[model samples]
Target: MSFRMIAQERPGNPWFSWDYVQGNSDTILAALREHAALTAQAVLIATVVAIPLAVLAYWVRPLTGPILALSGALYTIPSLALFAFIAPYLGTGTSTVLVGLVVYALLLIIRNTLAGLNQVPPEVRDAARGMGYGRLAQLLRIELPLALPGILTGVRLATVSTVALTTVGVLVGHGGLGQLILGGFRNNFFRAEIMTGTLLCVLLALVLDLLLAGAERLLTPWSRRRAEAG
Candidate 1:
């Protein structure tokens, strides 16, 4: 009648156990691996799309309003609601999640990209033009380099958001850390399930932030010099 009774039936089998996902070695490893893959895929796709759109928005100021508005709308939708809304049309799989992640990533990426470009002094652009550099050349060589720090900051935010939102993908039957939380919620073992999922998610995000920070340092060595100078 109760979960304990159900759990007793499968004694020592944590996977089939009543309280948790049985944390049996295989099940736990599988969940961890699945979550990592999904999160990586979603983040990778979002970065690809966001970087181009962000760069485009930076180059063409007029597009900023529309580009930002679209991303803003995506950000406004609650994660679960967004997944549910798209699941019908997209049919509940990784594709739907990818679309959602990209939409959410655009706002942060665009803003940061534009901000970073803006931070590049007007004189620099003028000097580049004063030289033989073409518009595309200046953008590729100068603008992107100068904007790296801000872009990385945007990436940091986007990464955190992606990790959080990916959890909701579970509602669509997609597995991630969200699956863990959802399973826990469904079973009503609030602490074990919720705690495990939440902690893992937090840890994942923090690790990503650290990695990105290290990457920013590696990619933007000039930024470190600038910091030292100031």
Candidate 2:
């Protein structure tokens, strides 16, 4: 599909003519919502997998190479090809799309998590250990808290990327804003829908990125306060 906006540009037609935009309000909203939902689901799933794997990789140095290699390998696969390979066994629908997106997300999230955890100062960990904190306790209370900044950086990337990629879900019969893009292209109509959907996708990614940044600030307030004092 062409995925072009206002390709014909009729004499009466204009980009984002109010009438077309208003008429397609429902569809635009629905697609926007579905796109958000799928992206969130995929990112959430990836986070669950990535965070723990990162910890494992850090704890077991031997696993680091293989874990990163695996995530990198999965991420290297073309989205459509990965979908084609998995869809047969997983069957069609949103589940397959979710899986593909999660796979796509793995590398960023995993690498970031590992980076964050490793960046925790050894002195801080030693202090925790001296204070009688066990491995798990020190990790949860000290390491992870300090690592929030970098880990959330990965989350911001994953969330934004997932939003962009979710458009591909339309091909597998999963509804997302991408469908409107394709719809507009295939029929050479609904240019407004395409424009609206495309903008909304960008808006969604921006919104999610901002939200995650806010979360990082809240979660790592100590760093901000420390920097201010310094």
Write down the lDDT of every candidate, Cα atoms only: 0.77, 0.86
CA deviation > 4 Å runs, candidate 1? 1-23, 188-190
Cα displacement (angstroms), candidate 1, residue 159, comes to 0.4
* Global Cα lDDT for candidate 1: 0.77
lDDT per residue as tens, model 2, 112-166 = 9999999988899889999999999988989888888888989899999899999
Q: Per-residue lDDT tens digits of candidate 1, residues 1-230?
A: 78766555644434333455454446555666667677677667776777778878877889978988888887898877777788899997878777777677767877887788889999999999999899889988988888889888988888888888777778777757787778866874544665677777889889988999999999999878999999
Cα-based lDDT at residue 53, candidate 1: 84
| lDDT value, candidate 2, whole model | 0.86
